[model samples]
Target: MNIPITNSIRHGRRYRQQGMVSTLIALIVLVVSLLAAMALMRSVDTSNTIAGSLTFRQSVLQEAERAYVDAQQKITFTQPTSDADNAPLGYYAEPQPATARSAGDVPNVLVNAVSGSIGSVTPLNSTDNSVTYVVERLCPTSGAATVTACIVPGASLLGATSSNQTSDNLTPFDNGAYAAFRLTVRVNGPKGTTAYVQTILR
Candidate 1:
């Protein structure tokens, strides 16, 4: 009878110890699973934030390009009246009249407008944003000359003596001339991404 009692007591203690160990292991697993879920959620949030910033940057770049093209067209079609001498119109500058020549003396106008506008849509870490752009025009030749002289000689048809003969006053251009008039654009986004674009008109 004494041996049987001792055996039963030992069995009871062993059962309790096994139950405690199992419970402890289950609690540890539960804690680890919760931590993993939280970490995954944070990572997803970060990715989404970066994607939003990139999208906004792209939109800003498009706006800048539009502004560049509009300025170029103004320069091409319109003649520079006396009002444009001291002031010049640009991406960010005040309105200046485009340069012009006599009815037909103008060379093929190369719209060489360049821009370097840089600003953040949002603060580096903030949610709100703002942007800025800079615009400039490049001359066709090295020295300062009237817009008319820039075109190759005989390229103008307005002064031609024979009204019956229309001169194809087109002038050939080199890569160097084309490169001389380039527009540069820079966009900075939230997070640390940046975008740049360059355009030229010949």
Candidate 2:
């Protein structure tokens, strides 16, 4: 009878040991699941931040177009003459520095143009984004746009004297018939987002 009692006690001890091991495994699984959940949440937050940034950038780009249109209207209605430096109207008969069109941080020329009495400011959207633009004729000096002084699109590559009459039967593309103008639009948005859009027009 004593042997049977001892054997029953050993069986009880073995069952308790198995139960403890099972509990430990469950606790480890729970910890691992919690860590995974935390990682997933972080990933989702990162994705949301990236998406929001992209959307904001796109909106800023669209706002730039509005400024561009305003510049166009100014050019059409005001009709800049051969005179240079129409600062009040944001029209310059002379070309801008290369730094204005460079990539990376905002150019000093644009900052000065916007801050000073040059370029007109127009509100972009309800978010308080504003735009300013400067139009620069691609010419070294003021007065009339000459072939040697200005950048003319579709100008004869062979030479200024070369005529296209034989090939296309059309009159020779005049090298200095029209001048090319560069439109630089700067946008200032919320959270200190600054963007520049530039285009050449003839």
Leading candidate by lDDT? 2
Backbone clash total for model 1 is 7
Q: State the weakest 10-residue window (summed lDDT) of model 2.
A: 163-172
> What digit string (tens of lDDT, one per residue) describes model 1 on residues 1-202?
4455887899999999999999999999999999999999999999998888667766656755664655455443212321132113323112223335332111112122223222212233342322332332233333332333333232332331111112243212322111113344444555454444554333
Q: Tell me, by TM-score, which candidate is best.
A: 2
- Which lDDT tens digits does candidate 2 get at residues 31-68? 99999999999999999989978887787677767767
- Model 1, residue 60: displacement in angstroms? 3.3
The 10 consecutive residues of candidate 1 with the worst lDDT sum are 103-112
How does candidate 1 score on lDDT? 0.40
- Predicted structure 2, TM vs. truth: 0.65
